[model samples]
Target: MRNLIHVLFFALVVSFSFSCKEEPRTPPNILFIAVDDLRPELGCYGKSYVHSPNLDQLAAESSLFENHYVTVPTCGASRYNLITGQLPKNPGDLSNQASVSNIANKPAGERPTTFMQELKQNGYYTVGIGKISHHPDGYVYGYHEPKSDKIELPGSWDEMLLKAGKWGTGHNAFFGYADGTNRNGMAKEVKPYEAGEVGDDGYPDGLTAELAIEKLKSLKQQDKPFFLGVGFFKPHLPFTAPKGYWDLYDEENIPLAPFAEIPENSSKASLQNSGELNQYKLGEEKPHLDRVASDAYARKLRHGYLAAVSYIDAQIGKLLDELEEQELAENTIVVVWGDHGWHLGDQKTWGKHTVFDNALHSVLMIKRPGESGQRISQVVSTTDIYPTIMELTNVPSQATLDGESMVSLMENPAAKHWRNTAYSYFRRGISLRTPQYRLTKYFRDQPPAMELYNHQNDPYESKNVANEKPKVVKQLMPIWKKGNTGIFKE
Candidate 1:
């Protein structure tokens, strides 16, 4: 009878051990979504016109950053910074060239290590879809098989529409001139859309979303975690979206550009140097565009831009819904970011180029599992994204990354020792943006020009107090120089 009792006691102990055993935790998957030329006009960003319910909902579930910025305002330059976690210092300003050029000329094994490459090294499957780069194929970024199934939007109207016999006009859209001679020379060619066709119907943006969904479904069947990048090309361009999205906003009801009243003491060079004054007019140069008469046209252009933004938001909503339906939300880390911001008549600028706040500031939303929804007002840069993903996935990064991990901030939004200021630079200028101040130094052959603004008092960046506050400029200059010490050293 004692032997029988011993056997029963052993069985009970085994059962208890089995019940208490911990299951292995699966590494979190990463869904990296990149949008081109998007500004901080989302519903969560306090903009009334742009309807980004999906992003706002994601923000509700994630950590939204209010002061996120990019290293550069151009697509290729900014993306290179994010992927490599390093400042872009390509010779000949090669960093801002189209992706195709960068990839083709990339030195063997010298390609800055990308986050996707690190993921692949750590045993995660990496998949890329859509305009991830300007490259003809996406392999340069490290996907094993760069999927090329993306749909082409209308090509240059001159080439695809007129020359192909599909449309009457065969001219390129008016992008700002390259030489600054015509001020309206053909920047690039774009296919003309039919009278009522939506931008996404023919463009690759919708197809990119479809491919992302398909990739996610395939990922669900596999046991391994994945790094899936979905890039959309809408809102970058010929101001096209489906007729349905356009109809959502009445042109008459569209808001006008916020009135910009230059101070009497402001330099004439500052006012005349506005990029908006020099944009292409009907695909040709009109030097008088900077004069007062162009205001009405500028208003119409802004309306089209806002409509494009809203349309892209709808497509984003579709992708987010799929994640929920597939049951991937709880296990996936969703990161939504714009490659860079766009300009809409701010500081006499119609597009990105200058190192102004409107160009350098971008929208960055991160949704990590188990994190409460909140806004992080700390200054952060695109370079931080790669390191953050590495920490979350438990993956070993092979390359030395320059960005500090924001995992601490993710766990505790009030975490201290965060960056005091974020750094941004272009070819001829460097900008230092902190929560309270912004200082810009533009280098020319002549004496360097400076602009300073107290963000606390002038949120619109309307005033330049550099002359009035020389001491502040002197203090910040060294700090900015220190942050950029290693940038051009190599």
Candidate 2:
């Protein structure tokens, strides 16, 4: 009987050892949410006026990057840099067709074009909804043309989906309105802002959220880890949202552009006309570099932007709730990133084609379960996201990337020996944002070819002190020149 008891104990110990040796650690799933033309102006970012409760909550649970900047200010180019993990190699790389013209047109080579494709190669079931790449529906077509069969970012997505709704096509749905019609078909007769009397599903973004939730439900049933990319289209153009969101704010109290005037000593060539906003010809006001919008009109526009933001916020909240309901939140790494920032009215501009801080600084938040939340102030670029994800997922990458892995910074916000710099390219110029100064060098032969703004004193960037601080420019020029990448080389 004593020998029998000893045999049972030995059997139990051997079984436990075998189980421990056989079990493998499961990698965390990635929920990547990208918002178009989103600026870092939320309650979590210290803008108490903006009604972004959902983003605020996510920021509370994640590492909120205060000084996060994009490589390019435009949508497609910026997203290209984010996916390819490379800087602008040529002039065409900085355009909106960077993805379709470069990656989609070419055959799939040995290297993956995007990090998502890398994840796919590493056994991740990748899915993309809405505007994940340059094209809204992951197709190659003009905004007014019929959707084509050519795919953008080929071999990247296992399933690329977009519910265009009544707009017919993804591009039309992108610039869509409350009604079934869109800006492309309306012949520039639409207004820039709309407060539709309908539910959340009245807009394309609503449908995007619903589809994303459905995908999440299905993804939870999959055996392998998934990388789900959900991109929201609102707050991008024709700022349209449900009336409930519009009611959340008072139009009278909305703040106007603090510095509507151009920067002193800054050349007009360094700025762009409010061309994107003025495309909506039916708007009540037209903003130009020299002409600023009236106070009432500016407030109205601000109210529209805020309403759209709140509407997207609600959609994000729905996604988060669904993630928790599916029991995926605990094992998923959630990342909410903005393609680029929009100038509501900074520097008398209303678009994101410039190299100013407002055009470059966007929203970036990352949440890893079981880790404490932090607000990282280190200057980081969108290119860094590629390596960061690779490290986070423990996926091996063979592609030559331009950005470095920021895992150390994400692990510790106040990390020592960290490079505090971000580079942005646009409008024939390459701008570098350090901890204290923003130095820009324009390739064009224009007056004030070099511009510098010290963030410590002129946070608004109301003045260019390049001539005033020649030594500072000389000190930063060598570092900023490295970002040229031969795009502006003669």
Candidate 3:
């Protein structure tokens, strides 16, 4: 009788324990969309004429950063900043070959920790597609080199993928046009812009988006949340897009850059004479610092760039729609960021590698599910994205990130104590953007070594007031020097 009573008591205890147990909570997923050479020209950034419906819609539900800056102006270095959350401190790290120059050379024990690596360690299915790193397709080698077993982001992703369509190789695709002729293949005889009557598959961006959508669907089947990175190549060079996007723009209506002349009192060292622009031997105009590019050709280039933007937007829409279809939008965190801004004839120069606003300022948007729209006016760096992602996904990471967490401003756009200064490095010089001025100081110890622009008075950046603003430079000099410390640890 006593044994029976004890058994009944134990059964009751087991039932009580089982009833009190809690179900494990699912974590939020991350969709990190990296757009190349995308400046703040979308409708969301108050550019009334640009057609970017999909990204604008994304901005409606995201935290739009009005003052976002990249650590480096070039491709590979800027990506290194985004991936590793560190600023470039050496000249070698600032090149387009930074993947091969720096990261690829480092031993596994001495490499910096990528946030994506942290996510993979913490049970997230990390995936990469297209130009997430320097290489157009995330595999290594030159524009014509064959694919090998080189991985850029070591230990970061479970699967790193690149699908180059008719263009053949990633390097060729990067410099390719609508008719499948790469600039290299054509011996630089390609025009600066081409609007071919082709479908979305006519460009590599479409194929990248398609691949990402497929990966998204597959990622949903996994038990853990995913970190999917999708990168699109467009508006970089040899501006090419489908006919439908090109039709949206009227060539005559495209406006030229307001500040087409070089800045007053600025040294020649601060500018490049559209060398990248001069690469295409078939271009309609030859752009030089002393001579202005033809207005007609400038309009054509802008038209092509806009078409590329719209094409990528349509591709982005496809990815977003897929997320909704899979019911993953409810718990996924979406972030859209450009590697760096492009100089569309601004500052009488073309291409990046400049410390000017045209090259430094880019686009950044972060959307948390159910979060209200907010515009963050405080200046933020690209490095901050790593910590922000870590905080957003609730992942535990011991990674030492160079950037601060942007979550406070994400919650409250006007949050205090937020960093108001942004830093960008190039060559031996570093540029600092504060609330009022942009100060650039060179380290070579030459004449006209410093350039300063007062943003309030000269919104166009047509003048350099460094010689006149000695007191201001004195105050900002330390801050400018403080930006030079993102040196990687061995």
Local accuracy by lDDT, each model: 0.64, 0.91, 0.86
TM-score for each candidate, following the candidate numbering: 0.82, 0.96, 0.94
lDDT of 2 by residue, 1-490 (tens): 9999999999999999998895577888999999999989789999999899889999999988999999999999999999999999788888999998779877666333699989999999999999998899889999889989888988888999999998989999999888888888999898998999989999999999999999999999999999999999878988999999999998898888778888999988988898999999899999888888888888888898889999999999999999999999999999999999888888989988999998999999999988878899999999999999999999999788999888899887898877889888898998999989999988887888889999999988999999999999999988987787888864
Q: For residues 1-490, could you state the per-residue lDDT of candidate 1 as single tens digits?
A: 9999999999999999999999989888888888878878888998866767778888888889888988877777787678768765543332554334444356536455667767876777777765554431242322222233321111101111111011111111112111121111333332211113534533345555666777788888877788787776656655656666667766676665563444323433333343343433342332221443255566556656766677667777888888889999889999988888765766655567656678788889999877679988888888898898889888878777767888888777677788757777764667788888888776544333777888897787778888888999998988777556334431
Give per-residue CA lDDT, model 3, range 1-490, as digits (tens). 9999999999999999999999766788999998889988899998888999999999988999999999899888999888888777677778877766666767978788889899999999999998898888777776767876788777888999877888898888888787777998898998888888889988888888889999998998998889999988887887899989999988899888989988899766788788888988998888878888788888888899999999999999999999999999999999999999988899888788788989989999999998887888899999899999888878876866778989988887777788888888885678899878889877654557888999989977899898898999999988887886744221
Number of backbone collisions per candidate: 8, 0, 0
Where does model 1 exceed 4 Å of error?
Answer: 1-18, 90-94, 98-104, 136-195, 198-200, 259-289, 446-448, 486-490
Task: Output the TM-score of candidate 3.
Answer: 0.94
Better of 1 and 2 by lDDT: 2
Candidate 2 residue runs with Cα over 4 Å from true position: 1-22, 110-112
Q: By descending lDDT, how would the candidates be arranged?
A: 2, 3, 1
Task: Kindly give the stretch of ten consecutive residues in candidate 2 with the minimal lDDT sum.
Answer: 104-113
Candidates' RMSD to native: 7.1, 1.9, 3.4
Ranking by TM-score: 2, 3, 1
Report the number of the highest-TM-score candidate: 2
> Would you give me the overall lDDT of model 2?
0.91
Judged by TM-score relative to the true structure, which candidate is superior, 2 or 3? 2
Residue 83 deviation, candidate 2, in Å? 0.5
Clash pairs (backbone) in predicted model 2: none
